[model samples]
Target: MFSGAQLSLYPMSDDFVGIITGALSALDPHRDHLRIETDDLSTLIVGPPEILFSAMRDLFVAAARSGTHCVLSATVSRGCPGEPDDPICTPAEGTLPVAPLDERIAKAVAAVKAAPETGQPVACQVSLYPLGVNQHMDEIEGCIAFLKASGVFDRPKNFCTKLSGDAGAVFATLQQAFTRFGAAASHVALDVTVSAHSPTRA
Candidate 1:
């Protein structure tokens, strides 16, 4: 399966360049495990879901630690037929096909519960797209059910669902929702925006 994410970081500060550059170092440990490329627009990370989410979490946390409001926008996808499979995207261990919706929802909830806290709190909105599947709505609904039970779920938004909590559980929830839905080899994508240290938060 081919899995990857294209993400951009925005730090609301005059020294945004410094903050972004310094925060990128958080991904250093994951460099060997992922194929990372950065241009003017966004950074593309290709690898297994575990390394992908962890790297994202670390990078976002590093930037947020600077005490500046930061937002991370990411489009994560897996099993897209348009993209060719790369050896680097292979997981260390193979995965089975997606299970029944109820089973998947249960497992996703369990995974989020087990996520370690990062102390850094984040608010995020996400919309999942399960493409090329006949029962896409079923998968989407199942994901929504899982999110509502994820403990981090904040509420439902206009076109997405809102989640707020420690960055750890939030990201874990996103990862689970992305992986547990749709067919194993089918295309699945997640549109996500995560904010930390926002001024408007009470």
Candidate 2:
């Protein structure tokens, strides 16, 4: 019942890093840059000896291996005050949303930047998020090749082979590339997300 408590842990050792990392990774993909502020998000885990024992033991073993002995505790902002709430952990190193491989990739995405209401092109930068970075290289190459061959774009060597049309075209092309690249590797947790120009009221 740790609803309004902050969950915090004292680092026991490098071994605990895995336990923390694993827990966070298993929970939220956006777990990173935790702090003792309102913005910080963590899972409050508190309970009897058996509840927090196993994970804590893992942390302890990790600390032992790491040659460090630190205490760790995290409280939740909303939950039962007496019992441990679900672990709300954010990873220390989460995946970056931008997966731009090279200058050419950036150029390719920029080339298809979204236009504004004035029907005029606005300068924009595109960021790619490559998931499952270590996967089938050949498949990745194939997707890029297909995009390049299909895009029919030249002159700007930096330009990507993204479908040259509107913002949607570029997005669609990127997805298509991922689908093609993920061949056979069903767990290919890799892909890129291009944030279109942010929408703001005039």
List, in order, the clash count of every candidate structure: 0, 34
Worst 10 residues of 2 by lDDT: 115-124
lDDT tens digits, residue span 140-175, model 2: 554465555434222122423222333334433443
User: What are the RMSD figures for all models against the true structure?
Assistant: 1.1, 19.3
Error of 1 at 84 (Å): 0.7
RMSD (CA, Å), candidate 1 to true, equals: 1.1
**What is candidate 1's lDDT per residue for 33-148, written digit by digit as tens?**
99999899999999998889989999999999999999999999998888998877776557734578888898889989999998999999999999999999998999999999
Error of 2 at 193 (Å): 4.8
Task: Point to the candidate with the largest lDDT.
Answer: 1
Q: How does each model score on lDDT? A: 0.92, 0.32
